[model samples]
Target: MDLLDDDELERSAVVANCRMNRERGLLGSNGYDRELGFNPLDVLRKPSGESRPAGWLDLCCGSGKALIEAARIVHDEGMDVEIVGVDLAGLFRRVDPDQDRLRLVEASLGDWRPDRGFDLISCVHGLHYVGDKLALIARAASWLTEDGLFVASLDLHNLKIADASPLGRRIAAALRRAGLEYDRRRRLVSCRGRKAVDLPYRYLGADDRAGPNYTGQPAVDSYYADA
Candidate 1:
């Protein structure tokens, strides 16, 4: 079996055309609030007026609808918030020009770095297509503010190895030790504050033909060697 590197994985049909959460909103049955188990707006804090707007970074932000909706709400409420939505496809839905606080970016999360730390960072179902899931997670976590919140949906089964049954347990333990929490049943990983996570594994590559995960979507399986 052949494995694809990050660049190859990004160019693959399964990843380039992935439309996960394309139309998801900020709040609703199929929205960020429900998916994240809390209203993202509640976590957004504006300190001492507009001197420094609260930042929210949404990775793999397909279509950026949710962030756009949040931007509208912030505008209406006169809240100081800056929202950035990044997607590899870069095919974002049309938005109004009045949305000055919202920025839709097209780039690969594997190498893209934000200019500033975020108060809240989310990745929805985006990690399903990433080649180096753990490495990205570590990078995202490190990009958070001291009291920032980072949440993402992750399928542990996709973290592949030669013998992966015990890999899940080990991974969960390592994450916990690094101040990140993994919900086994919910397939979610979350953390409060910035964490410098150094997992003891090297990313070998990814298998894009691994098939469907719990999301009932075809996802990539990341392989790893030893550190």
Candidate 2:
């Protein structure tokens, strides 16, 4: 089976048709707070005496509606926060002219890098279409602040090796060893604080025609080789 690289994966219809997280809001049953297991606003709020501005980076932020809403709350509460949302499709909703603290960017997670560490970083069902999910996860985890939180919806079955084995248990054990937690039931991966994780696998490519998994949506299958 021929697999697609990162750039090729981006152009595939399977990745383009991913809409599981496009309309997610900030504070509802189907919202970031519920998906991430914590309120990002609470993480961004300044502590009792600290003065540094809190930062949040949301990856694959479909329309950026959640980030925009968070920006409005930050402004209304007079909180020192910076919100940055990035999406590969670049189809974000327009924000108010005065929502200066919020920035929506169009970029690929494979190459995008933030200039500053964030107190909270989230990726909602974004890795389903990514070619190198582990690499991107490692990069995102490393972008966290000393006490930051990183969370994302990840389906372990989508990660596999050359023989088509999912390697789910092995991967989960490795992730836990690296200070990351994987909730098998929820299909959520989370990490506290910054970590430089080096999973012993080399990404080969991705199969965009893998069809649907647990999410009942078309998803990509990433293949890897032992490093």
Candidate 3:
């Protein structure tokens, strides 16, 4: 799929902007926070103090938060790595300047085609928005080099039969049609790993002891899916 097409890119931007606005309102804040969950860059750090990866791609990288983190890791570790962030909303454009090592492209995860494959690809909290989840996963897989890693997250809470939106229902239907087994009760899956991993769904401002009240909300279940 070619993501650079004008019409698709424009539509994708509109959806992304809407999502960003909704999330901003939910948080009641404009700044991005780091304590949300696991950091991919930190996970990629090596003990030898060497570079992380030759190149990094942040798919559906809204506001460039993850991309910024990756760039900081590269700079602090003195790694010669290139970082590219692709998002439909164009949020990265509004980020502060001095992101020299980072490049933001307006593209849809459902259709983007990078010039070169990446050594590490991250799709954080953005896969469910795509119209075709499996197609998007296939495309991302195609963009990974051998032994490359692909990190993706999906929100099972968003798929609740009671709270799910029409789009979410459609996504669930698609997954069913594709024969992908998903546990609606547990809100978790083991598509990539042998054991099911409990997805962390902590609110941006909520306390840890608050329990999983965030369930049935728009939370992401991250996975290190094979690339």
Report each candidate's C-alpha RMSD, comma-separated, in the order given. 1.6, 1.0, 11.0
Residues 74-97 of candidate 2: C-alpha lDDT, one tens digit per residue: 998899999999999898888999
Counting clashing residue pairs in each candidate, in order, gives 0, 0, 1
Selected candidate, larger TM-score, 1 vs 3: 1
Residues 1-227, candidate 3: write the lDDT tens digits.
Answer: 11223344244433434444223211113322221234445444445654444667776777675566556657677766778988776755344455567788876554568887676676654554544344555566567665555656554433322222223344445444543334454332213211112221211111111112232223222112222
* lDDT of each residue in 1-227, candidate 1, tens digit only: 58899889988887975557788888999898888888899999665654778999999999988988988899899888999999999888887888899999999887799999999999999999999999999999999999999999998888877543335677788899888999887788998999899998888888889888888889988888768
Clashing pairs in 2: none
- Judged by TM-score, which candidate is best? 2
**What are the clashing pairs of model 1?**
none
Highest-scoring model, lDDT: 2
The whole-model lDDT of each prediction reads 0.87, 0.90, 0.47
TM-scores for candidates 1 onward, in order? 0.95, 0.97, 0.54
Which regions of candidate 1 deviate over 4 angstroms?
47-51, 163-166
lDDT of 3: 0.47
